[model samples]
Target: MIDSKQKGMIFNVQKFSVHDGAGIRTLVFLKGCPLRCRWCSNPESQLFKPERAYNPNRCLTAEVCGRCAKACNEGGVTLIDGLICFDRSKCTDCGSCVNACPTGSQTVYGYEMTVGEIIKKVEEDDVFYSRSGGGLTLSGGEALAQPEFSLALLREAKRHRLATAIETCGVYPTEVLAEACKYLDELIFDIKHLDDEKHKKFTGGSNEQILKNIQYVFENFPSLPVTVRTPVIPGFNDTEEEIMAIRRFVPLRDNVQYEVLTYHRLGSPKYGYLGRPYLLGDVKADDDFMRQIRAKLREYQG
Candidate 1:
Protein backbone atom coordinates (compact mmCIF):
# COMPACT_ATOMS: atom_id res chain seq x y z
CA MET A 1 0.00 0.00 0.00
CA ILE A 2 1.15 3.50 -0.71
CA ASP A 3 1.88 5.79 2.20
CA SER A 4 -0.45 8.70 3.10
CA LYS A 5 2.11 11.07 1.59
CA GLN A 6 1.80 9.28 -1.75
CA LYS A 7 -1.95 9.63 -2.05
CA GLY A 8 -3.81 11.13 -5.02
CA MET A 9 -3.00 12.04 -8.61
CA ILE A 10 -3.93 15.55 -9.71
CA PHE A 11 -4.45 16.70 -13.27
CA ASN A 12 -4.74 20.49 -12.91
CA VAL A 13 -4.67 23.08 -10.17
CA GLN A 14 -6.99 25.76 -11.64
CA LYS A 15 -6.77 28.95 -9.65
CA PHE A 16 -9.25 31.82 -9.41
CA SER A 17 -12.12 29.72 -10.69
CA VAL A 18 -15.33 31.65 -10.14
CA HIS A 19 -17.98 29.51 -11.82
CA ASP A 20 -17.27 26.15 -10.13
CA GLY A 21 -18.08 27.10 -6.57
CA ALA A 22 -18.56 30.19 -4.42
CA GLY A 23 -16.18 33.13 -4.73
CA ILE A 24 -12.76 33.01 -6.45
CA ARG A 25 -11.66 29.44 -5.75
CA THR A 26 -8.83 27.12 -6.62
CA LEU A 27 -10.12 23.88 -8.16
CA VAL A 28 -7.80 20.93 -7.48
CA PHE A 29 -8.75 18.46 -10.22
CA LEU A 30 -8.11 14.89 -9.00
CA LYS A 31 -7.40 12.11 -11.48
CA GLY A 32 -9.33 8.86 -12.18
CA CYS A 33 -13.06 8.48 -12.72
CA PRO A 34 -15.62 5.65 -12.73
CA LEU A 35 -18.21 7.21 -15.03
CA ARG A 36 -17.59 7.85 -18.74
CA CYS A 37 -20.02 10.67 -19.35
CA ARG A 38 -20.31 11.38 -23.06
CA TRP A 39 -20.36 15.14 -22.51
CA CYS A 40 -17.53 15.43 -19.99
CA SER A 41 -15.79 18.81 -20.21
CA ASN A 42 -12.52 17.55 -18.75
CA PRO A 43 -11.76 14.31 -20.58
CA GLU A 44 -8.12 14.60 -19.48
CA SER A 45 -9.16 13.95 -15.87
CA GLN A 46 -10.82 10.65 -16.75
CA LEU A 47 -7.66 8.54 -16.83
CA PHE A 48 -5.39 7.70 -13.88
CA LYS A 49 -2.18 7.62 -15.91
CA PRO A 50 -0.58 10.57 -17.64
CA GLU A 51 -1.70 10.87 -21.28
CA ARG A 52 -0.24 12.92 -24.11
CA ALA A 53 -2.20 15.69 -25.87
CA TYR A 54 -1.40 17.46 -29.14
CA ASN A 55 -2.75 20.86 -30.11
CA PRO A 56 -2.49 20.95 -33.88
CA ASN A 57 -3.24 24.65 -33.98
CA ARG A 58 -0.30 25.37 -31.67
CA CYS A 59 2.26 23.50 -33.83
CA LEU A 60 5.07 25.48 -35.47
CA THR A 61 7.55 23.99 -37.85
CA ALA A 62 10.17 25.53 -40.12
CA GLU A 63 13.04 23.98 -42.17
CA VAL A 64 14.09 22.11 -39.01
CA CYS A 65 14.53 18.34 -38.66
CA GLY A 66 12.48 15.78 -36.67
CA ARG A 67 13.79 16.40 -33.15
CA CYS A 68 10.54 15.33 -31.39
CA ALA A 69 10.47 11.95 -33.17
CA LYS A 70 14.03 11.26 -32.02
CA ALA A 71 13.13 12.24 -28.42
CA CYS A 72 10.32 9.67 -28.21
CA ASN A 73 11.47 6.12 -27.37
CA GLU A 74 8.34 4.35 -28.67
CA GLY A 75 8.70 5.74 -32.24
CA GLY A 76 5.13 6.99 -31.80
CA VAL A 77 5.85 10.32 -33.50
CA THR A 78 6.43 10.83 -37.22
CA LEU A 79 6.67 13.90 -39.40
CA ILE A 80 3.92 13.99 -42.01
CA ASP A 81 3.95 16.92 -44.46
CA GLY A 82 6.24 18.86 -42.12
CA LEU A 83 3.67 18.40 -39.29
CA ILE A 84 3.93 16.02 -36.37
CA CYS A 85 1.73 12.92 -36.56
CA PHE A 86 1.48 11.30 -33.12
CA ASP A 87 0.44 7.67 -32.73
CA ARG A 88 -1.55 7.36 -29.52
CA SER A 89 -1.31 3.58 -29.21
CA LYS A 90 2.50 3.43 -29.37
CA CYS A 91 3.02 6.36 -26.98
CA THR A 92 4.16 5.65 -23.40
CA ASP A 93 3.46 9.15 -21.93
CA CYS A 94 7.05 9.78 -20.91
CA GLY A 95 6.61 13.52 -21.76
CA SER A 96 9.90 13.41 -23.65
CA CYS A 97 8.23 14.51 -26.86
CA VAL A 98 6.49 17.34 -25.04
CA ASN A 99 9.81 18.57 -23.72
CA ALA A 100 11.51 18.16 -27.09
CA CYS A 101 8.80 20.05 -29.01
CA PRO A 102 10.13 23.62 -29.20
CA THR A 103 6.80 25.22 -30.20
CA GLY A 104 4.84 23.48 -27.39
CA SER A 105 2.63 21.33 -29.58
CA GLN A 106 2.87 18.24 -27.39
CA THR A 107 1.53 18.21 -23.81
CA VAL A 108 0.61 15.69 -21.15
CA TYR A 109 -2.30 15.63 -18.76
CA GLY A 110 -2.30 14.39 -15.15
CA TYR A 111 0.51 14.33 -12.62
CA GLU A 112 1.01 12.47 -9.33
CA MET A 113 1.37 14.88 -6.43
CA THR A 114 1.38 14.40 -2.68
CA VAL A 115 -1.08 16.07 -0.30
CA GLY A 116 1.65 18.30 1.11
CA GLU A 117 2.61 19.40 -2.40
CA ILE A 118 -0.99 20.34 -3.22
CA ILE A 119 -1.44 22.22 0.08
CA LYS A 120 1.66 24.27 -0.57
CA LYS A 121 0.34 25.34 -3.98
CA VAL A 122 -3.12 26.07 -2.63
CA GLU A 123 -1.71 28.11 0.23
CA GLU A 124 -0.20 30.52 -2.30
CA ASP A 125 -3.68 31.95 -2.95
CA ASP A 126 -4.62 32.40 0.72
CA VAL A 127 -4.99 36.13 0.24
CA PHE A 128 -7.45 35.67 -2.63
CA TYR A 129 -9.52 33.20 -0.59
CA SER A 130 -9.58 35.45 2.41
CA ARG A 131 -10.71 38.47 0.43
CA SER A 132 -13.35 36.72 -1.69
CA GLY A 133 -14.68 34.11 0.77
CA GLY A 134 -13.15 31.45 -1.42
CA GLY A 135 -10.84 28.49 -0.85
CA LEU A 136 -9.91 25.13 -2.28
CA THR A 137 -12.47 23.02 -4.18
CA LEU A 138 -11.75 19.31 -4.71
CA SER A 139 -13.10 18.31 -8.15
CA GLY A 140 -12.36 15.50 -10.54
CA GLY A 141 -13.31 12.52 -12.54
CA GLU A 142 -14.64 11.81 -9.11
CA ALA A 143 -13.00 13.19 -5.99
CA LEU A 144 -14.51 10.44 -3.82
CA ALA A 145 -12.86 7.81 -6.01
CA GLN A 146 -9.63 8.76 -4.20
CA PRO A 147 -11.26 8.94 -0.78
CA GLU A 148 -8.25 8.95 1.54
CA PHE A 149 -6.39 11.60 -0.40
CA SER A 150 -9.44 13.81 -0.64
CA LEU A 151 -10.19 13.45 3.07
CA ALA A 152 -6.61 14.31 4.01
CA LEU A 153 -6.60 17.35 1.71
CA LEU A 154 -9.88 18.53 3.15
CA ARG A 155 -8.61 18.09 6.69
CA GLU A 156 -5.51 20.08 5.90
CA ALA A 157 -7.53 22.78 4.17
CA LYS A 158 -9.71 23.06 7.28
CA ARG A 159 -6.62 23.18 9.44
CA HIS A 160 -5.58 26.29 7.54
CA ARG A 161 -9.08 27.74 8.16
CA LEU A 162 -9.96 27.70 4.48
CA ALA A 163 -13.49 27.11 3.19
CA THR A 164 -13.63 23.81 1.35
CA ALA A 165 -16.01 22.47 -1.33
CA ILE A 166 -16.20 19.24 -3.33
CA GLU A 167 -17.74 18.66 -6.75
CA THR A 168 -18.78 15.02 -6.74
CA CYS A 169 -20.93 12.73 -8.85
CA GLY A 170 -22.10 10.99 -5.65
CA VAL A 171 -21.34 7.47 -6.90
CA TYR A 172 -18.98 6.31 -4.12
CA PRO A 173 -19.71 4.31 -1.01
CA THR A 174 -21.67 5.98 1.78
CA GLU A 175 -18.85 5.65 4.29
CA VAL A 176 -16.37 7.44 2.07
CA LEU A 177 -18.82 10.22 1.31
CA ALA A 178 -19.56 10.73 4.98
CA GLU A 179 -15.90 10.94 5.91
CA ALA A 180 -15.11 13.44 3.17
CA CYS A 181 -18.12 15.53 4.13
CA LYS A 182 -16.82 15.84 7.68
CA TYR A 183 -14.21 18.40 6.57
CA LEU A 184 -15.96 20.07 3.64
CA ASP A 185 -17.93 23.26 4.18
CA GLU A 186 -19.94 22.81 0.95
CA LEU A 187 -20.87 19.95 -1.37
CA ILE A 188 -21.55 20.42 -5.09
CA PHE A 189 -23.35 17.21 -6.05
CA ASP A 190 -24.19 16.52 -9.67
CA ILE A 191 -27.60 15.15 -10.73
CA LYS A 192 -27.46 14.38 -14.45
CA HIS A 193 -30.79 12.70 -14.90
CA LEU A 194 -33.84 11.78 -12.87
CA ASP A 195 -34.55 8.44 -14.52
CA ASP A 196 -32.27 5.65 -13.41
CA GLU A 197 -31.96 4.09 -16.85
CA LYS A 198 -31.03 7.35 -18.56
CA HIS A 199 -28.54 8.18 -15.83
CA LYS A 200 -26.81 4.85 -16.27
CA LYS A 201 -26.90 5.08 -20.05
CA PHE A 202 -25.20 8.49 -20.17
CA THR A 203 -22.94 8.49 -17.08
CA GLY A 204 -21.90 4.76 -17.26
CA GLY A 205 -23.39 4.25 -13.76
CA SER A 206 -26.72 3.99 -12.08
CA ASN A 207 -28.33 6.79 -10.07
CA GLU A 208 -29.30 4.48 -7.19
CA GLN A 209 -26.12 5.07 -5.19
CA ILE A 210 -25.97 8.71 -6.24
CA LEU A 211 -29.50 9.35 -5.04
CA LYS A 212 -28.95 7.44 -1.82
CA ASN A 213 -25.84 9.47 -1.00
CA ILE A 214 -27.49 12.81 -1.72
CA GLN A 215 -30.55 11.91 0.35
CA TYR A 216 -28.34 10.68 3.17
CA VAL A 217 -26.34 13.92 3.18
CA PHE A 218 -29.44 16.06 3.08
CA GLU A 219 -31.29 14.13 5.76
CA ASN A 220 -28.40 13.68 8.15
CA PHE A 221 -26.30 16.78 7.65
CA PRO A 222 -28.77 19.60 7.30
CA SER A 223 -26.14 22.25 7.92
CA LEU A 224 -23.88 21.09 5.12
CA PRO A 225 -24.46 23.53 2.25
CA VAL A 226 -25.39 21.51 -0.84
CA THR A 227 -25.80 22.72 -4.42
CA VAL A 228 -27.12 20.28 -7.02
CA ARG A 229 -25.86 21.06 -10.56
CA THR A 230 -27.11 19.34 -13.73
CA PRO A 231 -25.21 19.75 -16.98
CA VAL A 232 -28.06 20.26 -19.44
CA ILE A 233 -26.91 18.27 -22.43
CA PRO A 234 -28.68 18.45 -25.79
CA GLY A 235 -29.99 14.98 -26.71
CA PHE A 236 -29.14 13.20 -23.48
CA ASN A 237 -30.96 15.25 -20.82
CA ASP A 238 -32.05 18.77 -21.92
CA THR A 239 -35.78 18.24 -21.59
CA GLU A 240 -38.08 20.07 -19.22
CA GLU A 241 -39.27 16.87 -17.58
CA GLU A 242 -35.68 15.79 -16.88
CA ILE A 243 -34.75 19.12 -15.31
CA MET A 244 -37.92 19.23 -13.19
CA ALA A 245 -37.40 15.66 -12.06
CA ILE A 246 -33.95 16.65 -10.78
CA ARG A 247 -35.45 19.67 -9.03
CA ARG A 248 -37.95 17.38 -7.30
CA PHE A 249 -35.12 15.28 -5.90
CA VAL A 250 -33.57 18.26 -4.13
CA PRO A 251 -34.06 17.67 -0.42
CA LEU A 252 -36.24 20.08 1.49
CA ARG A 253 -33.26 21.51 3.29
CA ASP A 254 -32.82 25.19 3.99
CA ASN A 255 -29.15 25.29 2.98
CA VAL A 256 -29.49 23.68 -0.47
CA GLN A 257 -29.74 25.21 -3.97
CA TYR A 258 -30.37 23.70 -7.42
CA GLU A 259 -28.50 24.83 -10.53
CA VAL A 260 -28.98 24.05 -14.22
CA LEU A 261 -25.68 24.25 -16.08
CA THR A 262 -26.29 24.80 -19.79
CA TYR A 263 -24.08 22.71 -22.01
CA HIS A 264 -21.33 24.26 -24.15
CA ARG A 265 -18.82 23.03 -26.73
CA LEU A 266 -15.83 24.39 -24.86
CA GLY A 267 -14.30 20.93 -24.49
CA SER A 268 -14.61 19.78 -28.11
CA PRO A 269 -11.05 20.86 -28.86
CA LYS A 270 -9.90 18.64 -25.98
CA TYR A 271 -11.16 15.52 -27.79
CA GLY A 272 -8.94 16.29 -30.77
CA TYR A 273 -5.97 16.93 -28.48
CA LEU A 274 -6.60 13.62 -26.66
CA GLY A 275 -7.03 11.71 -29.95
CA ARG A 276 -10.64 10.86 -29.03
CA PRO A 277 -13.75 11.31 -31.12
CA TYR A 278 -16.06 14.17 -30.32
CA LEU A 279 -19.46 12.81 -29.30
CA LEU A 280 -21.33 16.05 -28.73
CA GLY A 281 -20.68 18.17 -31.80
CA ASP A 282 -21.86 21.72 -32.46
CA VAL A 283 -24.71 21.21 -29.98
CA LYS A 284 -25.39 23.80 -27.31
CA ALA A 285 -28.30 25.06 -25.25
CA ASP A 286 -28.88 28.80 -25.62
CA ASP A 287 -29.38 31.33 -22.81
CA ASP A 288 -33.11 31.52 -23.41
CA PHE A 289 -33.39 27.80 -22.83
CA MET A 290 -31.29 27.97 -19.66
CA ARG A 291 -33.37 30.87 -18.32
CA GLN A 292 -36.53 28.95 -19.12
CA ILE A 293 -35.23 25.93 -17.27
CA ARG A 294 -34.22 28.07 -14.33
CA ALA A 295 -37.71 29.62 -14.30
CA LYS A 296 -39.29 26.17 -14.32
CA LEU A 297 -37.10 25.11 -11.39
CA ARG A 298 -38.41 28.03 -9.37
CA GLU A 299 -41.81 26.39 -9.48
CA TYR A 300 -40.41 23.61 -7.28
CA GLN A 301 -39.20 26.07 -4.68
CA GLY A 302 -40.24 25.27 -1.11
Candidate 2:
Protein backbone atom coordinates (compact mmCIF):
# COMPACT_ATOMS: atom_id res chain seq x y z
CA MET A 1 0.00 0.00 0.00
CA ILE A 2 1.20 3.50 -0.79
CA ASP A 3 1.95 5.64 2.21
CA SER A 4 -0.81 8.13 3.05
CA LYS A 5 1.84 10.74 3.85
CA GLN A 6 2.44 11.23 0.14
CA LYS A 7 1.08 14.55 -1.11
CA GLY A 8 -1.50 14.90 -3.90
CA MET A 9 -2.34 17.83 -6.11
CA ILE A 10 -5.66 19.36 -5.00
CA PHE A 11 -7.65 22.33 -6.24
CA ASN A 12 -9.41 23.17 -3.00
CA VAL A 13 -10.35 21.73 0.39
CA GLN A 14 -13.67 23.26 1.38
CA LYS A 15 -14.68 23.01 5.03
CA PHE A 16 -18.06 23.09 6.76
CA SER A 17 -19.82 21.91 3.63
CA VAL A 18 -23.43 20.88 4.34
CA HIS A 19 -25.09 20.04 1.00
CA ASP A 20 -22.45 17.57 -0.29
CA GLY A 21 -23.32 14.78 2.22
CA ALA A 22 -24.84 13.89 5.55
CA GLY A 23 -24.29 16.53 8.26
CA ILE A 24 -21.67 19.32 8.13
CA ARG A 25 -18.80 18.02 6.05
CA THR A 26 -15.34 18.87 4.75
CA LEU A 27 -15.32 18.66 0.93
CA VAL A 28 -11.98 17.76 -0.71
CA PHE A 29 -12.06 19.02 -4.33
CA LEU A 30 -9.53 17.00 -6.30
CA LYS A 31 -8.17 18.08 -9.67
CA GLY A 32 -8.33 16.39 -13.11
CA CYS A 33 -11.31 15.19 -15.17
CA PRO A 34 -11.96 13.05 -18.28
CA LEU A 35 -15.43 14.32 -19.23
CA ARG A 36 -16.02 17.88 -20.39
CA CYS A 37 -19.62 18.58 -19.35
CA ARG A 38 -20.85 21.79 -20.95
CA TRP A 39 -22.79 22.73 -17.84
CA CYS A 40 -20.15 21.95 -15.25
CA SER A 41 -20.26 24.38 -12.33
CA ASN A 42 -16.66 23.85 -11.26
CA PRO A 43 -14.65 24.15 -14.47
CA GLU A 44 -11.53 25.01 -12.50
CA SER A 45 -11.48 21.43 -11.17
CA GLN A 46 -11.07 19.96 -14.67
CA LEU A 47 -7.33 20.47 -15.21
CA PHE A 48 -4.62 18.68 -13.26
CA LYS A 49 -2.17 21.56 -13.73
CA PRO A 50 -2.51 24.94 -12.10
CA GLU A 51 -4.25 27.65 -14.21
CA ARG A 52 -4.45 31.41 -14.19
CA ALA A 53 -7.77 33.24 -13.83
CA TYR A 54 -8.44 36.93 -14.42
CA ASN A 55 -11.26 38.70 -12.63
CA PRO A 56 -11.76 42.06 -14.38
CA ASN A 57 -14.07 43.14 -11.57
CA ARG A 58 -11.08 42.86 -9.25
CA CYS A 59 -8.61 44.78 -11.49
CA LEU A 60 -7.12 48.05 -10.37
CA THR A 61 -6.08 50.79 -12.77
CA ALA A 62 -2.58 50.57 -14.29
CA GLU A 63 -2.34 54.22 -13.28
CA VAL A 64 -1.56 52.69 -9.92
CA CYS A 65 1.28 50.96 -11.90
CA GLY A 66 1.28 47.69 -13.93
CA ARG A 67 3.09 45.66 -11.28
CA CYS A 68 1.23 42.51 -12.33
CA ALA A 69 2.42 42.88 -15.94
CA LYS A 70 6.00 43.49 -14.80
CA ALA A 71 5.89 40.37 -12.59
CA CYS A 72 4.71 38.00 -15.39
CA ASN A 73 7.44 36.41 -17.54
CA GLU A 74 5.07 34.71 -20.03
CA GLY A 75 3.44 37.84 -21.49
CA GLY A 76 0.08 36.65 -20.11
CA VAL A 77 -0.93 39.90 -18.47
CA THR A 78 -1.94 42.80 -20.72
CA LEU A 79 -4.33 45.74 -20.63
CA ILE A 80 -7.31 45.71 -22.96
CA ASP A 81 -10.16 48.23 -23.03
CA GLY A 82 -9.14 49.45 -19.59
CA LEU A 83 -9.46 45.90 -18.24
CA ILE A 84 -6.79 43.25 -17.67
CA CYS A 85 -6.64 40.62 -20.40
CA PHE A 86 -5.06 37.32 -19.38
CA ASP A 87 -3.88 34.84 -22.01
CA ARG A 88 -4.28 31.62 -20.12
CA SER A 89 -1.93 29.72 -22.43
CA LYS A 90 0.90 32.12 -21.70
CA CYS A 91 0.40 31.82 -17.97
CA THR A 92 2.87 29.67 -16.01
CA ASP A 93 0.73 29.61 -12.86
CA CYS A 94 3.77 30.71 -10.83
CA GLY A 95 1.40 32.92 -8.79
CA SER A 96 3.79 35.86 -9.18
CA CYS A 97 1.14 38.13 -10.70
CA VAL A 98 -1.39 36.95 -8.15
CA ASN A 99 0.93 38.16 -5.40
CA ALA A 100 2.03 41.36 -7.18
CA CYS A 101 -1.50 42.43 -8.15
CA PRO A 102 -2.51 44.84 -5.40
CA THR A 103 -6.11 44.54 -6.60
CA GLY A 104 -6.38 40.71 -6.59
CA SER A 105 -7.07 40.39 -10.34
CA GLN A 106 -4.80 37.42 -11.00
CA THR A 107 -5.72 34.12 -9.31
CA VAL A 108 -4.44 30.59 -9.75
CA TYR A 109 -6.25 27.26 -9.49
CA GLY A 110 -4.97 23.94 -8.03
CA TYR A 111 -2.63 23.40 -5.09
CA GLU A 112 -0.26 20.68 -3.92
CA MET A 113 -1.25 18.88 -0.72
CA THR A 114 -0.51 15.63 1.04
CA VAL A 115 -3.01 13.16 2.52
CA GLY A 116 -1.63 13.78 6.03
CA GLU A 117 -2.01 17.55 5.55
CA ILE A 118 -5.64 17.20 4.41
CA ILE A 119 -6.44 14.84 7.31
CA LYS A 120 -5.06 17.42 9.69
CA LYS A 121 -7.36 20.05 8.17
CA VAL A 122 -10.38 17.75 8.42
CA GLU A 123 -9.59 16.79 11.99
CA GLU A 124 -9.89 20.41 13.04
CA ASP A 125 -13.68 20.02 12.82
CA ASP A 126 -13.87 16.55 14.36
CA VAL A 127 -16.24 17.77 17.01
CA PHE A 128 -18.66 19.15 14.43
CA TYR A 129 -18.51 15.93 12.38
CA SER A 130 -19.25 13.74 15.40
CA ARG A 131 -22.00 15.98 16.69
CA SER A 132 -23.79 16.37 13.35
CA GLY A 133 -22.99 13.00 11.77
CA GLY A 134 -20.97 14.81 9.13
CA GLY A 135 -17.65 13.63 7.79
CA LEU A 136 -15.43 14.05 4.73
CA THR A 137 -16.83 14.28 1.16
CA LEU A 138 -14.52 13.62 -1.81
CA SER A 139 -15.58 15.60 -4.90
CA GLY A 140 -13.81 16.63 -8.06
CA GLY A 141 -13.75 17.17 -11.75
CA GLU A 142 -13.89 13.37 -11.25
CA ALA A 143 -12.50 11.80 -8.09
CA LEU A 144 -11.93 8.44 -9.69
CA ALA A 145 -9.74 10.11 -12.31
CA GLN A 146 -7.14 10.19 -9.54
CA PRO A 147 -8.04 6.83 -8.02
CA GLU A 148 -4.82 5.99 -6.19
CA PHE A 149 -4.53 9.32 -4.42
CA SER A 150 -8.22 9.43 -3.66
CA LEU A 151 -8.22 5.90 -2.27
CA ALA A 152 -5.21 6.66 -0.10
CA LEU A 153 -6.87 9.82 1.20
CA LEU A 154 -10.04 7.89 1.97
CA ARG A 155 -8.04 5.27 3.81
CA GLU A 156 -6.31 7.91 5.91
CA ALA A 157 -9.66 9.49 6.75
CA LYS A 158 -11.00 6.04 7.73
CA ARG A 159 -7.94 5.41 9.91
CA HIS A 160 -8.97 8.50 11.79
CA ARG A 161 -12.42 6.90 12.20
CA LEU A 162 -14.25 9.57 10.18
CA ALA A 163 -17.22 8.84 7.95
CA THR A 164 -16.56 9.28 4.21
CA ALA A 165 -18.58 9.95 1.05
CA ILE A 166 -17.74 10.41 -2.65
CA GLU A 167 -19.40 12.46 -5.37
CA THR A 168 -18.53 10.91 -8.73
CA CYS A 169 -19.50 11.22 -12.39
CA GLY A 170 -19.43 7.37 -12.73
CA VAL A 171 -17.21 7.54 -15.84
CA TYR A 172 -14.44 5.30 -14.52
CA PRO A 173 -13.75 1.59 -14.72
CA THR A 174 -15.68 -0.77 -12.44
CA GLU A 175 -12.58 -2.10 -10.74
CA VAL A 176 -11.30 1.34 -9.82
CA LEU A 177 -14.70 2.44 -8.56
CA ALA A 178 -15.15 -0.79 -6.63
CA GLU A 179 -11.89 -0.21 -4.77
CA ALA A 180 -12.89 3.33 -3.85
CA CYS A 181 -16.39 2.25 -2.89
CA LYS A 182 -15.01 -0.09 -0.28
CA TYR A 183 -13.94 2.92 1.79
CA LEU A 184 -17.04 5.05 1.32
CA ASP A 185 -20.07 5.19 3.61
CA GLU A 186 -22.23 6.86 0.93
CA LEU A 187 -21.99 7.48 -2.81
CA ILE A 188 -23.46 10.45 -4.67
CA PHE A 189 -23.61 9.61 -8.36
CA ASP A 190 -24.40 12.07 -11.13
CA ILE A 191 -26.73 10.89 -13.91
CA LYS A 192 -27.00 13.66 -16.49
CA HIS A 193 -29.11 11.92 -19.14
CA LEU A 194 -30.65 8.51 -19.61
CA ASP A 195 -30.02 8.45 -23.35
CA ASP A 196 -26.58 7.26 -24.28
CA GLU A 197 -26.07 9.49 -27.32
CA LYS A 198 -27.34 12.54 -25.50
CA HIS A 199 -25.06 11.82 -22.58
CA LYS A 200 -22.08 11.50 -24.91
CA LYS A 201 -22.94 14.72 -26.73
CA PHE A 202 -23.04 16.68 -23.49
CA THR A 203 -20.50 14.98 -21.22
CA GLY A 204 -18.05 13.81 -23.95
CA GLY A 205 -18.51 10.15 -22.90
CA SER A 206 -21.08 7.40 -23.44
CA ASN A 207 -23.56 6.35 -20.78
CA GLU A 208 -22.69 2.68 -21.22
CA GLN A 209 -20.20 2.47 -18.33
CA ILE A 210 -21.82 5.12 -16.19
CA LEU A 211 -25.24 3.48 -16.15
CA LYS A 212 -23.70 0.04 -15.75
CA ASN A 213 -21.68 1.15 -12.75
CA ILE A 214 -24.70 2.60 -11.00
CA GLN A 215 -26.65 -0.61 -11.57
CA TYR A 216 -23.70 -2.65 -10.40
CA VAL A 217 -23.35 -0.66 -7.18
CA PHE A 218 -27.06 -0.80 -6.45
CA GLU A 219 -27.38 -4.54 -7.08
CA ASN A 220 -24.27 -5.41 -5.09
CA PHE A 221 -24.48 -2.87 -2.29
CA PRO A 222 -28.17 -2.29 -1.78
CA SER A 223 -27.65 -1.34 1.85
CA LEU A 224 -25.10 1.40 1.08
CA PRO A 225 -26.56 4.91 1.02
CA VAL A 226 -26.74 6.29 -2.51
CA THR A 227 -28.15 9.45 -4.02
CA VAL A 228 -28.75 9.93 -7.75
CA ARG A 229 -28.46 13.54 -8.86
CA THR A 230 -29.49 14.96 -12.24
CA PRO A 231 -28.50 18.50 -13.17
CA VAL A 232 -31.46 19.95 -15.11
CA ILE A 233 -29.60 21.67 -17.94
CA PRO A 234 -31.73 23.78 -20.26
CA GLY A 235 -32.11 22.59 -23.91
CA PHE A 236 -30.40 19.35 -22.89
CA ASN A 237 -31.99 16.95 -20.39
CA ASP A 238 -34.66 19.03 -18.67
CA THR A 239 -37.70 17.55 -20.36
CA GLU A 240 -40.32 15.56 -18.47
CA GLU A 241 -39.59 12.49 -20.58
CA GLU A 242 -35.90 12.64 -19.67
CA ILE A 243 -36.62 13.06 -15.96
CA MET A 244 -39.07 10.14 -16.01
CA ALA A 245 -36.52 7.98 -17.82
CA ILE A 246 -34.07 8.61 -14.97
CA ARG A 247 -36.80 7.88 -12.43
CA ARG A 248 -37.25 4.43 -13.98
CA PHE A 249 -33.67 3.55 -13.05
CA VAL A 250 -34.01 4.45 -9.37
CA PRO A 251 -33.99 1.36 -7.21
CA LEU A 252 -37.19 0.83 -5.25
CA ARG A 253 -35.14 0.63 -2.06
CA ASP A 254 -35.98 3.31 0.48
CA ASN A 255 -32.27 4.05 1.08
CA VAL A 256 -31.88 5.60 -2.37
CA GLN A 257 -32.84 9.23 -3.01
CA TYR A 258 -33.21 10.94 -6.40
CA GLU A 259 -32.70 14.67 -6.88
CA VAL A 260 -33.07 17.14 -9.77
CA LEU A 261 -30.58 20.01 -9.57
CA THR A 262 -31.62 23.14 -11.46
CA TYR A 263 -28.95 24.54 -13.77
CA HIS A 264 -27.06 27.75 -12.93
CA ARG A 265 -24.36 29.93 -14.54
CA LEU A 266 -22.15 29.96 -11.49
CA GLY A 267 -19.15 28.50 -13.33
CA SER A 268 -19.47 30.42 -16.59
CA PRO A 269 -16.93 33.01 -15.51
CA LYS A 270 -14.32 30.31 -15.00
CA TYR A 271 -14.50 29.39 -18.67
CA GLY A 272 -13.84 33.00 -19.62
CA TYR A 273 -10.85 33.20 -17.28
CA LEU A 274 -9.48 29.95 -18.67
CA GLY A 275 -9.82 31.41 -22.20
CA ARG A 276 -12.50 28.82 -23.07
CA PRO A 277 -15.97 29.42 -24.44
CA TYR A 278 -19.07 29.08 -22.27
CA LEU A 279 -21.46 26.95 -24.32
CA LEU A 280 -24.56 27.57 -22.21
CA GLY A 281 -24.43 31.36 -22.32
CA ASP A 282 -27.30 33.00 -20.41
CA VAL A 283 -29.13 29.68 -20.41
CA LYS A 284 -30.46 28.64 -17.02
CA ALA A 285 -33.55 26.74 -15.92
CA ASP A 286 -36.07 28.99 -14.27
CA ASP A 287 -37.54 28.20 -10.83
CA ASP A 288 -41.00 27.54 -12.30
CA PHE A 289 -39.58 25.08 -14.82
CA MET A 290 -37.51 23.33 -12.16
CA ARG A 291 -40.59 23.02 -9.93
CA GLN A 292 -42.58 21.52 -12.79
CA ILE A 293 -39.87 18.95 -13.44
CA ARG A 294 -39.72 18.07 -9.73
CA ALA A 295 -43.50 17.75 -9.60
CA LYS A 296 -43.43 15.46 -12.65
CA LEU A 297 -40.85 13.21 -10.98
CA ARG A 298 -43.02 13.03 -7.86
CA GLU A 299 -45.77 11.38 -9.91
CA TYR A 300 -43.52 8.36 -10.52
CA GLN A 301 -42.33 8.04 -6.90
CA GLY A 302 -45.04 5.56 -6.02
Question: What TM-score, over all chains together, does every model reach?
Answer: 0.94, 0.94
Q: Write the per-residue lDDT of candidate 1 for residues 25-65, one digit (tens) a residue.
A: 99999988989898898999888877789887777653464
Model 1's TM-score against the true structure: 0.94
Model 2: residue 106 alpha-carbon error in angstroms: 1.0
RMSD of each: 2.0, 1.8
**1-302, model 2: which lDDT tens digit per residue?**
55467667688989999999999999999898889898888999888877677777677767666788888888888777755567777877778889998765777888888888899999999999999999999999888888888999998889999999999999889988888888899999998898888888988889899999999899888889999999989888878888878988887678899999988888888787767898777876778988887887787776
Question: In model 2, which range of ten residues has the least summed lDDT?
Answer: 1-10
Instruction: Mark the regions of model 1 whose C-alpha exceeds 4 Å error after superposition.
Output: 1-4, 62-66
